[model samples]
Target: MELTAVHEHVWVIRGAVNMGLVRTQGDGLVAVDTGLDKQAGKTLEKAAKEIGLPLRAIVNTHAHADHFGGNAYLLSRTPVTVYAPEGEAAVIRRPMFEPEYLWQGASPLPQLQNKFLLAQASPVHVEYTPGVPFEVDGTTFLPVALPGHAAAQCGILVHDVCFAADAYFDPPVVDKHGVPYMVDYLATCRSADSLRSVQAAWFVPGHGEPARRPDAVIDYLKQRHEQAFQTVLAACRHPRSLDELLADVCRARNLAPANPGAYVLLRTPIAAYVTAAVGQGRMEIIMDGGKLQFLTIEK
Candidate 1:
């Protein structure tokens, strides 16, 4: 992992998941987010030690495994307080909640318990209020609410650099994933709108290079979100069960959820689209032969 200085006090460890580091007054640092697993966390710890900065604390922007998976490892190495957003604190505290919720409150299958959905449980010392600035070891951080990618997800703002944790995907990542994962479509759009209004010198996404033009990035995300909504709507013109709709939408988008993990990941976002359409009165849910189905409303 390469640690590049993004601001006077902010440095980002660019890897599979971009982790942010903010130098404090002392020989300490506040890590914004950890990577996918314990090994990823160890990498960050090693890099920090090499730079003569010990991790004083960690601020997780969300509860997603990829964003906070390294929490357990980091804490194991050093005594550090972990801060997470209020709604996400519960999930971070009980990593199993992620897969449990993903499987709709039922016991998740082995495949669903992968690192993509479940991270090692980490204790949260503080449940931060979104949009509130808090101080840690003489450094200040504002947790900007940017929910939609995950429940109660927030972006960390420090030294004019906003570490946007999955608020939106980089254009290429969006293209690669085909269907971006989101729980609430409208909330995601609102979060994009919120990011557009952020006056930041630089913005760091969870999985992309830091952006100088956050507005442009948000614009692209908005367009993709709209397209996703339309795609799901078109797939529902003929009443179809959730499974059938998922298949048709995947086929139309040239997406293949080849594994159980990929299937569940894609299924959740598609379910979000159906919920958004129903909220807008553009679609309705019905029962067909003991199966739940969705049908597009005739305009």
Candidate 2:
């Protein structure tokens, strides 16, 4: 992991995750988000120590395993406290909640139990309120409510730099996965609009490079999400089951899921789009032939 100084007091690890480090009045560093697992946490700790920055605390943008998975490892070795948005904090405290919900609240399959989806439990020492300036020692972080990816995610703003944790992916990382991984279609779109107005000098996303002006990147994300939603909506005209709609959208996009764990999760995006359509009166849920199906409403 490489730490590049973005601002005088703000530095970011530019790799898979744009993990942030904000120097405080005491010169200690506050980690924006931990990485994938223990090894990532170890590397991060080593990186900070190499630069003479002692770890003080962590602010997890969301409860997704990849973002906060290293929290447990860091807490095990360091005295750093963790802060997360309330609903997300609840999930991080009980890491299994993600996989359980993904698997319809039943026992999650072994494939869904990997570090990618399941991380060691992490304690949330603080529940930050969005739109409020979160204080850590003498440092103040403006935590913006960036829901959609997770129920309660926040984008931390410090030193004129916005640590937009997956609020919108950068160009190369946009739609990296076949299906858009979102829980709520409308919320995700609104968040795209919200991300563009954060007024930060630099926007560092969880994936891809930081952008000074991210209009193009954010627009691309919106376009892709619109296409995904429209694809699902179009397929619903024929009254298809959720799985069938997923297949139709994937086939139209010429994408293949990497594994069963991934395929199962794709249902979320599909359901999100369908739910939006239902809310907008463009689609209706029905039961036909003992199967749940979605049908486009005739306007």
Q: 4-120 in candidate 1: lDDT tens per residue?
A: 888978888998789988888765898999989998899889778867888999999999899889999999899999999999999999999998888899999999898988999
Off by over 4 Å in 2: none
The top-ranked prediction according to lDDT is: 1
lDDT of 2 by residue, 1-299 (tens): 78888898888888887688889988899999998899879878887887787899999999999899889898988799899997889889999998998888999998899998999999999999999887886899999988887778889999999988887887566656756577887888788789777788998989888889778888888898898888888888898998898889889998788886788778887888999999999998899889999999977
Give the TM-score comparing model 1 with the true structure, all chains together: 0.98
Question: What TM-score fits each model?
Answer: 0.98, 0.97
Q: Show the lowest summed lDDT stretch of 10 residues, model 1.
A: 213-222
User: Which residue runs of candidate 1 sit more than 4 Å off their true CA positions?
Assistant: none
Candidate lDDT scores, in order, read: 0.89, 0.86
